[model samples]
Target: MKSEETPFEGGPMDGRSLPVLVGPTGNPPKTYRIPVPDDAGGPPTVLVYRRVPRAHSKRLGLPKGWKYEFDPEGKRGGGPRWPWSKPDPAPDATPGGKPDDTHG
Candidate 1:
């Protein structure tokens, strides 16, 4: 697991650099989440940051690096709930948790 020193912009994480873990493709996760502890002992608040291009080469227009930008929305379930992105729910499971076999 390789990491890169990534910079963040805007929100509470503005102008901060942190080492982010990159995947096998040598790219960091699209979304970075940070959980801040609640002073009142409630659920922690999560801050979301979205990945974006830091700069592009003027000659060939290739991306130079990546950075994280604060997402104001920062809400849960922010991404598209596309059918392909998620596994389809079982529509015919019996009460015992086995699939109904009459159709099969």
Candidate 2:
């Protein structure tokens, strides 16, 4: 018996489950799913989507930072606030970058 081989065989009819690798398939690292909106039964809702900001906009133009937000109400917050702009800078990105030492 080969050590690497499993006793179970996977196929369509066997009720076997398969793992699907998401990357390189046009799937981003993180994805979320939501059902279609219903007006009558569903309450008025707000949706916020956040992502590491991009340098360019696919529709608008050049963009900055890695933080962004989206709401369904057609209103958007100001652009991302750069984490590096603080006087102390985020300690994680500084020398001796361990998390515990960040308070100094």
Query: Who wins the TM-score comparison?
Result: 1
Error of 2 at 71 (Å): 3.1
The TM-scores, one per candidate, come to 0.72, 0.17
Candidate 1, 1: how far from true, in Å?
1.3
Q: Using lDDT as the measure, which candidate wins?
A: 1
- Candidate 2, residue 76: the lDDT equals 40
The runs of at least 3 residues in candidate 1 whose Cα sits more than 4 Å from the true structure, single-residue gaps closed, are: 76-104
Per-residue error (Å), model 2, residue 74: 4.6
| Model 1 lDDT per residue over 6-73, tens place | 99999999999999999998889989999999999999999999999999999999878999999989
Please provide, for model 2 over 1-104, each residue's C-alpha lDDT reduced to its tens digit, 9 standing for 90 to 100: 11111111222113322232234542222311224456798854443333333467778875442322333443443456687754445545846765565567
Candidate 1 TM-score, C-alpha based: 0.72
